[model samples]
Target chain A: MTGLRLAAVLLAVFAASFALAQGDPRRSGYREMGPALQKMQDDDAANPAMLFVQAGAAAWAEKAAAGKSCADCHGDATASMKGVAARYPAFSAEAGKPIDLEGRINLCRTTHQQAEALAPESDGLLALSAYVALQSRGQPIAPPDDARLSNLRAEGAELYKRRQGQLNLSCANCHDDHAGRKLAGATIPQGHPTGYPIYRLEWQALGSLKRRLRNCVIGMRAEPWSYDAADYLALESFLMQRAKGMAMDAPGVRP
Target chain B: MSRALAALLLLLPGAAVAQQDSMPSLTGKPGDPARGRAIVANRTVGLCLLCHGAPIPEERFQGNLAPSLAGAGSRATPDQLRLRVADAARLNPDTIMPPYYRVDGLTRVARSFQGKTILTAEQIEDVVAYLASLKD
Candidate 1:
């Protein structure tokens, strides 16, 4: 009887130790999932950038400032706006530079939509641009290679290669050189703008290409610039040009 | 230097803790071997052909990115294999694997796949069993 009690106590001690070793008492679940689970959960939504598409779809018809809807001017995106965004980041003669989707949307709103210039990083602007770009999903991106775009691309490429910040590292270090290596918890997707504005679960909202780039810089522990800054826009131009043949998946879902 | 030795010591425990060898073994086959084989070929059940190759006589269209799971039985432990079947990302952490199990806490599943998991728990158990049944 005493030996049986001792065996029972030993088994209990071993079980308790095992339970303690696998911490997070309840394991909180997928709701508060560890990063691995979170990444797994994002696969479908992230790859196709589906949430961005849905959000963009909604933003297309919804009226915004000055009581004007994007639909009020552009009509049905599928019909009227087909192949429109695929031709960006185009050379804008007026701006004398390559203008990406965000700048183009602001230009349209100011000229025809009778709306105010959307403040960079504003939800309204992101939604509007995302809505506009979703129309070009699956279209082969056709970024301009004319003199204007060429100049911007050069500048952007220069910026990407330039060593920046405390780490004195260039974007080339991780994105260009080490495209497929692991970075802590996530696979380093080859930085591409074929999908934006994306709905990222981390942000729990739709965001733009510029937002994604700024986050990358911030992740590198560097000082990031404002949304749609010229430097960032030029960098975007370079990426769109590089990933030209890949099908567009604007307004994508991302982890 | 002591720092290098300390780093090696720290890594030694992680290797021991990984338990790479103690994976669970599949109990008596829980699924029909034929059904599991068909599942591996079917898009709905296996879709394994999308990323892997098989020894089955005929069929093509297998991508070459990932290693062939043809003889996965000898490669990994069953518990670790279960984690991969549940969600490859759960095991690899950086993989692009679809979560075959609803092991990752998901709520309000994505649109196109709103009502279903990539593979049901039963399906995963069966597939693992079938894979375990395979020999080199």
Candidate 2:
């Protein structure tokens, strides 16, 4: 074959491989977790994350600075919050960007409750997030379809594929290329964000989805973005969209 | 240096380590294949078996994402293999293999590991030496 034809063929092969790498069907991290952890997630009474869920229920009722609680504005969380977590990391016209469940909770804390914004990964924030997400349990994830979210989602997709850190690993490297493969004795999951405020046995505490993202980046030997960074919000949006049809499994247990 | 001395160099904080960019070729004495073999088999260290199916039959759960390391010496030259192990990004921009030496352009590094490379210079040489010895 001529040099030009060979180059063309090589380019096509490269493009095909790249597309194949990105086109893997999504699967939940739940399926990738160990059986012992799966049992913990199935039983609310046995799950340690339930403590935060209970705390969040209390926080929902306790009055904030303006003599109002989350219960005051949205009464009967069971009725109001069902399937709510499935639609978060959404575009906020008020903020002019995508906001995750933690972002929305802080927004309400300051705007509606007249209270201070909770710190990222704080007990109060994790509890509240866990409680809210628990309500969406069994609901299929369905991130918003606003035209405004298109740009943010695109940015997120880029970040997910972009290689970073000294290790030079991207989200796709582990979650996409090696999903179901072993790494340091643990199965590398597809990394769908079907659960947040998950009860990771390794952490021994409830953590937001952003916290988990930060941990992965750190494992790659890369610097992690701070809490509420736009990059994180974009990634969260992308992950939620990836898991769009998967059942919500917040207060999830993982080893 | 003895194996104990190499272990001491890794354990000692701020041990006059060479930065990733400064050293291009493998530095220090010729790599000891025995030490390299141990590092490659170690899960917490080289993590080679995590992704590549090396010739270590004793290790379970070997991965298949990358090519097997059996008879790797005949497949590529020592320098080519060294670069590939140090940082395969130069060969394939999207490879999942972590750079064993290069340190810049990373994000979210931990407080204690700001300037440290994943594998020490000696460890990299050892791993390379071990790969070079894999005749079959």
On lDDT, the leading prediction is 2
lDDT by residue (A1-255, candidate 2, tens digit) is 699999999999999988965684666889787788888889988999999999999999999999999999999999999999999978778776778888899999998889999999999999999999999999999988888888888899999998877667889888888888777457888888887888888888778888899998887767788785888888888888888878898879877
B1-136 in candidate 2: lDDT tens per residue?
A: 6999989977665434323223345685778889998898987788788788888888888876678899888886666678788887666767788878877766655655677888998888888888889986
Q: Lowest-scoring 10 consecutive residues by lDDT in candidate 1 chain B?
A: B103-112
Candidate 1: residue B118 lDDT (0-100): 68
Which clashing pairs does model 1 show?
A: A30-B105, A46-A253, A49-A252, A49-A253, A52-A251
True contacts kept of 2: 0.52
Task: State which docking tier applies to candidate 1.
Answer: incorrect
Candidate 1 lDDT by residue in tens digits, A157-255: 888876543223467766665554444334446677766777677887777778888786664335677675788878987877776666676656566
Error of 2 at A198 (Å): 0.7
| Candidate 1 local distance difference test against the native | 0.65
lDDT per residue for candidate 1 within B9-82, as digits (tens), equals 99998976575423343343365656667787774457676556666556555544356777777876566666
lDDT of each: 0.65, 0.83
| lDDT (Cα, 0-100) at B56 in candidate 2 | 83
